[model samples]
Target: MAQDWQQLNEQVTALLKTAREQVLAKMQSPLTVDEKTNRKDLVTNVDKSNEQFLIEQIHQIDPAARVLGEEGFGDTLQDLDGRVWIVDPIDGTMNFVKQRDNFAMMIGIYQDGVGQLGYIYDVMQDVLYHGGPALGGVFAGERRLKAPANIALADGLIGASGPLVVHDISHMQAIVHASAGMRVYGSAGIELINIMLGKTLGYISYLKPWDIAAGKVLLEALGCQVTTIDGQPLNMLSSNLVLVATEKAQRDILQIEEDDVSL
Candidate 1:
């Protein structure tokens, strides 16, 4: 079983590596950008192509595997049971089509509701944050990572979305206000990378499964907590206000938002 799982990881990693290269090769291709909900929520043909490629690979490898891809090409998943592969073919699609520097490709594999593997590829930088709780996560190009200290909200830098900071959703302003300082990266993948590196104590935002899947595995392995804003378990199929923080930071964060905050 372990060997089979390892083989799956390698196969998925190969697909991700290929997807990364394909996006890089088409980085400056003709702009076929469009909006999802608003102009800010962008998607491109590259995102579609990448997701399609990955889904095909998963189907060929494990026909029973369900893929939750960012590009609306996966199953209408209401439950996250059985073997599921959550993928963000191109995170930071806005950055991908606009600046092309801050995007990422992410994949998270779960077996019967347990996180088995996670991979986040920073295409331009060529860094892959991969591994699992079973194997312990790794940066894939560096020495073994030390799990970040269990720090409070005020102990280290925090990451958040720019709009949330301004809008003060769920008292996000108050949460970061108690922190030493706040950093808004506008890209979930980049912000998550900061948390994994122990550069930030916490990162909170309204995130979807694919948006936070890979980060969830890597950060939790580094002794961080990834859950809802109120310290509730994450619903893999639903979008919620996601909180990624150390244990000490969790209490400080849950206090910032009001009671009954999940909408």
Candidate 2:
């Protein structure tokens, strides 16, 4: 069957907005939270409900499409063979539950393992960053985004995972010192947004499939590099220490000299 990618993009855009409304409505009341892995890793009624809502609506739009969602409301897929949708109903669940801000809802559509369209909605800010290769370029709402300047590492701010920076993993401290500074936003979507807007030159973090999926589509469309910390292709099925940055920043990062660097 022939797929109308533009039409699919339109449908997904509307779906993201509707999911945002549902999430905001659910947040108006008290939330029931639970620990997933540890004290710091949490999930809430809002996360589960939002994932269910998104998956259900997505099936209605493309009944043949397979969905992989964080909350276990979708399929247990082992491969990305066909039309596959990866969704993080709410990224930064910790920020969402505690701060009620700095969280985003992200969705990415792929066909035969190629990204087709992506959407990341900053619910509290009411800003949506969306688009893909098929859409020509990325956009912040109706405004088309230009490619961010290819700034070098030492000349621009970098986004980093808090744990990575604190623990000095992968010579993270050295990498940060090589840059102007580091900012930890706790949400990959927000970090990606800052990069796309040219507010930050790069971001490095440990990310799962859903965490990087949507942002990958958007950033790659904008000519940014999205790769593993070692500058390898992403598996999309495995968690990785990922790097998203402009070309020059990526080169600077990959070539940073690791030595006795202190914070």
Candidate 3:
């Protein structure tokens, strides 16, 4: 399984590089863009094309795996009962279309509802954040990353989505008061990367499966803790306010739930 996995990783990395080239080439052309929830929630031609490309590659390797893609490009998933590949072909789609940076390609592979492998590719920077539960996480091409310290909340920086921070849901107002500082990156993949490299102490936001799937797995493998804001284990198919923190931070943050406001 290790050898097979190594080969698969190599293949997936190559594919991500190819997709990056395709994305850059397409950026020079006019975009076929549309909105889903509102005007700002955008999707572009590149998003659909990238999803198609990745799904094709996945089919070549594991045709039996059920694929859930962000662009409505795969199976209509109601449950995570089988082997599933939860994917976000372009995680920061708004940033991709507007800023041409900060977007990422992420995939979380699970077998029988248990996370196995997770990958997040920061395409523009050419950094692939990939790892498995059986193996430690990696950054750049060769550097082995160390797990973050399980720091207490008041002693560390908090990585939070801006809207959530402004609203103070889940007593995030109290959370904000307890943190050393606050940072928001608008991208789950990017935020996860910072947490993995010890740039931030924790990340919390309302996230979907494709949004937080690979990230949660990667963070957990790097000695970080991930759970719902109320301290329950994550349910893969639901959109919920998720928290990724070090062990000590999790303990401190979970206490805020007692006075948290429901959205």
Candidate 4:
């Protein structure tokens, strides 16, 4: 049976609203925070509860679809061989626990490994960025987003992962110097939102599957490029130093990386 993407999108949108309400209500109280890997890497009660809610709702929407949720509440799959949904219940957990402003909830639906639909909800701002190839194009709320200008690396602000810049990995400092400036918003979804809105030329970060999945769908649908640092295609299952940028900026950054190795 063919999936009605439009109908599925509608259902997912409503589910996100309910998730948002739950998150906002939880913000009134203290969060139950725990360290995941380190003090820097944290998770909260909200993250787990939200993932459970989302995965349960998704199962109700399509019993055949499998979900890869960040909180380990969903199905375990060896491959994206069927209808699959990748979800991040709370992206930027540190920001959510500390500031509660810059975090987001994201979901990406794929079929046999092909991106079908994406939703990025900026929970605090009440903005939802959603859509994909099947739905025609990407949108923020109701406004259709146009392709961002093809700005080069030297001419535009570049978004960087703070740690990458601090460590000077991948010649990140040189990349920043070649750009007009740098911005690190601490959230891949939020940084991708900046890219989709044309507020920044590009962003470079090491991201997990859940972190980059939804933004990859939304940004690519808006005519932006998402790839590895060397301009390689992503496998969609492993963590990598991902680059999301306008075409021109992508070319410029890759060139810089190439030149750095020659020196």
- TM-score of each candidate? 0.93, 0.96, 0.94, 0.97
- Runs in model 2 lying further than 4 Å from the true structure: 1-3, 257-263
User: Once model 2 is optimally superposed onto the true structure by TM-score, how far is the C-alpha of residue 173 displaced, in angstroms?
Assistant: 0.2
User: 232-251 in candidate 1: lDDT tens per residue?
Assistant: 98988879899999889987
| lDDT of every model, 2 decimals | 0.83, 0.90, 0.84, 0.91
Identify the candidate with maximal TM-score: 4
lDDT of 2 by residue, 77-140 (tens): 8899999999999899989988999999999988889987889999899999999987888999
Tell me the deviation in Å of residue 73 in model 3.
0.9
Clash totals for all models, in order?
0, 0, 0, 0
**Candidate 4 residue runs with Cα over 4 Å from true position:** 1-3, 261-263
| CA lDDT, candidate 1, residue 1 | 82
Give the lDDT of residue 180 in candidate 4.
94
> How many clashing residue pairs are found in candidate 3?
0
lDDT for each residue of candidate 3 in 177-202, tens digit (9 for 90 to 100): 78898888778899898898888899
Across residues 1-263, which tens digit of lDDT does each residue of candidate 4 receive? 23588888889999999999999999999999999989998999999999999999999999999999988999887899889999999999989998889999999999999898899999999999999976889999999999899889888899999999999889899889988999999888899899999899999999888998899899899888999999999878778899999999999889989888421
Using lDDT as the measure, name the better of candidate 1 and candidate 3.
3
Worst 10 residues of 4 by lDDT: 254-263
